[model samples]
Target: MNLKATIFGLLVFFISGQFALAQSTEIEKEITELSKKKWQWMADKNADSLAVLFHDKAKFVHMGGTWGKDREVDIIRSGGIHYKNADVHEVMVEVLNENTVILWNRITLLAVVGSNEVTNPFMVTEVYVKEDGNWKLADLTFSKLMTRD
Candidate 1:
């Protein structure tokens, strides 16, 4: 190709690439919002909505060393992990090439389980994957802060 033609082609390619990246960022943000809403739904014991946000291969690791997808679903069903009051202070998103994203955040959870009241701050991480144009949680992990007496 001629020099001028080559330059124009390169410019167009660069612009389109940038546009695609911007669009991907926006889409990732939307997915993050959806994931947070799903957590809220879980806290509210809205099993139907929460189920929709989890992929078929979703796995969860509790801070207490519990691991099991079926048990996680059961916990949600029985309100075992209900969050009466919680706050997500910060969310950091790492995009893994358009279809996979990793989310990390710090959260403060204050709630009652049965008759016992628990309040703790924790760091949470979750992996989300896009399937058929929707993002769903594929893996989840949480760790609680420990304090010395």
Candidate 2:
């Protein structure tokens, strides 16, 4: 009966692993699409939409300085820093748990800072947390890269 029990345990483990993989894949797609929408929203200066997505205590890191959600929203709304365009070259998502995920994006960003427009290649890291059934952005950091492909 020990051999039968071992076989049953193995089957259960295999099935559970498959389920987890499938769930992670679904989350990956959802996050990827959400990220794409976020870029568009930033370009359009849709601060309201972004406000909903960003957590109240979210952190935003930039070349100028690091700030919180409110400042970021205001900057976008006021056009102080206009996100003109974002060309996403690569996207990767890691689901840490059901409630948390981390995403990395390699992008070429065009922005208007004050009166001058500039372009930069960056590797952006975004951390998302699921709260009350909604995925909220918790932290976003931009790391400037030297070369662009």
Question: Per-residue alpha-carbon lDDT of model 1 for 25-130, expressed as tens digits?
Answer: 9867876787688668867888777677778778887756656566677777886777676578878888887788888867887766666778888777888888
Per-model TM against the reference = 0.86, 0.97
Write one digit per residue (lDDT tens) for candidate 2, span 28-55. Answer: 9998898899999999999999999999
Candidate 2 residue runs with Cα over 4 Å from true position? none
What's the lDDT for candidate 1?
0.77
Among all windows of 10 consecutive residues in model 1, the one with the lowest summed lDDT is 140-149
Residue ranges of candidate 1 with Cα displaced over 4 Å: 146-149
Listed per model in order, the count of residue pairs whose N, CA or C atoms clash below 3 Å is: 0, 0
- Top candidate on TM-score is 2
